[model samples]
Target: MLHLRAICPAERTDAVLAALKAEPGVTHVVLLRGAAVDPVGDVVEADVAREATDQVVASLCDLGVDRDGGVTLEQIDTALSDAADRAEEAAPGDGADAVVWEELLARTGEESRLNATFLSFLTIACLLTAVAVVTDSPVTLVGAMVVGPEFGPLAAISVGLVLRRWDLVRRAALALAAGFPVAMLITAVGTWLGSRTGLFDPDLALAGHELDFVFEVGPFSLIVALLAGAAGMLSMTSAKSAALVGVFISVTTVPAAGYAAVAAVLGQWDICLQSIAQLAVNLVGVVVAAALVLALRNRRGQVRDLGRPLGNG
Candidate 1:
């Protein structure tokens, strides 16, 4: 179930209440007249079935409650009322199977921003991967994968593509285009500096390392990338946080960037190229597969791009 709160302008309150009452997925409706101070409106609240969030939200937006007023949706952990149960039953689909698009849009938008935290996390993941390569630490390599923030932007790009929001696609693309290079460049510099300081041995790149798999680009790598992308997107749409971590651990995107940076620092041009290829393959594979998943998920109105586009065209 979901808790919905809409602060409606005095004139829109009746229309908002009518819409809420008309939704079979909605229950526990309450109206607090002139309750809003900042927005200066009446507060209308309701409990809605999770699976019907999109429908209920759309109804409110159509009544202009979202613009002239404010609408907020929140997850409901425990709705013990009988009406809540009826609302859930009245909903057309399972909650877990539903895609709350507004939540996803907001999430991906924030994630796609090329901000300090995103840069720091990516750089740190790469540095971790570099260390894992030098030391052949499987644990560190896995840790690097988990720490990577790249998936967020990648998911953003996929979502944007599916919705045909070119501005979203461009913003997300900016993050990827800028973030990876910045991370790789910093990791390369750090590796070189560490070598000079005796923190790492430059010759380690030439040595046989089990972590070399991080740099190997093969057909299997693409297959794994595709599978990871699908699983990642499914998890995101389903709002399963735990499943997302598994996706992170399954991909080598972060480790590949780290391997490339370390190889470049060691002047192992061939290995650097190989790692770069691996990185590219993984990224392309994930995005392509994720976009496909989103396109298919949009079938039967499971997901809809209803809001105004950020793009001009």
Candidate 2:
């Protein structure tokens, strides 16, 4: 279940209440008239089923509650009310399958920014992968995968394409374009430093290692990427996010890029090209798969919203 709180303008309070009362998924509606001070409006609150969160939120936004005042949503860990159970049963879809696009757009906007922190994390993740490659350690590679922050922008790009948000698509594309090269360059420098310090041996890097599959770009790689991307989008939109870590582990984007950087610094042209291909394959596969999943869910959400009224101008 989800709890929603809205500060509505005096004139829109009645419309907000009517919208909530009309939705079968909403219950326990509370209206405190003239309770808002800063926003100078009424305080309205309601409990809604998770499956119906998108519709209810869309309804509130349609009434211009968000523009005139504010709307806040929080998950309810424990709602012991029988009314909450009844509401959930009345909602059309399963809660776990619900897609709240507004929340997703907000989250991806924050995550996909091309800021110092994002660049730093990308650099660090690639560096870790470089170390893993030189040492031929699967554990280190997995650690690098866990630390990589590239998935945010990739997912954002997919969502942007589905929603036709050109700004978001451009922002995410710019972040990836700038961030990856910078990260790879830093990783190359680290590789040179490590080799100079006797920490990384070029012979060990060139020799076949147990983790060689990280460098292989093939149909299998694309299949793995597609699966990971689907799982990733599901984890993002659904209530359970625990599966996200598995998606991170299943992808080879960071490791492949790291290998490419290290191979380039060591003057191994063949390995460099192969690693680059691996990185490209994984990235393209994920983007295509995620876009499809989001597009399908978006269609369903739109179908559900067909008769909804537009927000006040």
Candidate 3:
């Protein structure tokens, strides 16, 4: 179940309650008249079934309740009420298949931030990949894959593109554009310093084909990336976060950057260019596949919601 709290102007209070009462998947309605101080409005709260969240939120947004007031939605750990059960049963689809647009906006926006933590994780993942490159360590390469933080921005790009949110698309693009180069540069420098100090082998790097899949741009690479992107987006929409880690391991963005850095340090220009190409291919595949998935879902949802668009909600 989802808990929704909305601060609505007193003038809109009756309409807000009307919307909630109209939805069969909403229950436990509570109204606190004149409870809102910040927005100086009435407070309206309700328990909504997960599958009906998109429609309910859209109805409120259409009322302009979010303009003069605000809406906050969250998950309820436990709701031991028959009304909640009836609401969930009345909802059209399975809860696990529903996509909450507002929740996704917040999640993807946070992921697309090019902050210190994002930079550090990308750089660290690439550094680990560089080490894996020198040692030809498959386990360490997998570790680097797991440590990469590019998933969020990639998801943001997919969601943003589908929703036609240009600002979000540009923001996520900036994060990737700014993040990869920085990580690669740092990894390259680290590799160079390590080689100079006898901590890494430039010679061994020449035979580093074990991790070459990262730079081996081909049809199969794009296929894997496309598959990973679809799965990753589905995981986010359905709130099955555990699946995202697997998607991370499937994509080769961080590993490619790591390989590019090591190859640059070893003076292997061909491999470096190929690695960058592979990285671009993988990112493109992920973005395209995820956008397609979201677009399809949105279109279907429009029909299911009786002309109300789901993505824009």
Highest TM-score: give the candidate number.
Answer: 1
Give the per-residue lDDT of model 2 (tens digit) for 20-55: 998999999999999999889999999989888888
Model 2 stretches with alpha carbons more than 4 Å out: 300-313
Candidates sorted on TM-score, descending: 1, 2, 3
Clashing pairs in 2: 62-311
* Residue 234 lDDT in candidate 1: 89
User: What number of clashing residue pairs does each candidate have, in the order they appear?
Assistant: 0, 1, 0
| Candidate 3: residue 288 lDDT (0-100) | 90
**Model 2, residue 222: C-alpha shift (Å):** 0.6
lDDT to native, each model: 0.87, 0.87, 0.88
Q: Once all C-alphas are superposed, what RMSD does model 3 give against the true structure? A: 3.4
The number of the candidate with the highest lDDT is 3
Clashes of 3: 0
TM-score of each: 0.95, 0.94, 0.92
lDDT of 2 at 123: 93
Write the number of the candidate with greater TM-score, choosing between 1 and 3: 1
Residues 143-246, model 3: lDDT tens digits: 99999999899989888787777777888899999999999999999999999999967887759467878898999999999999999989998868789889
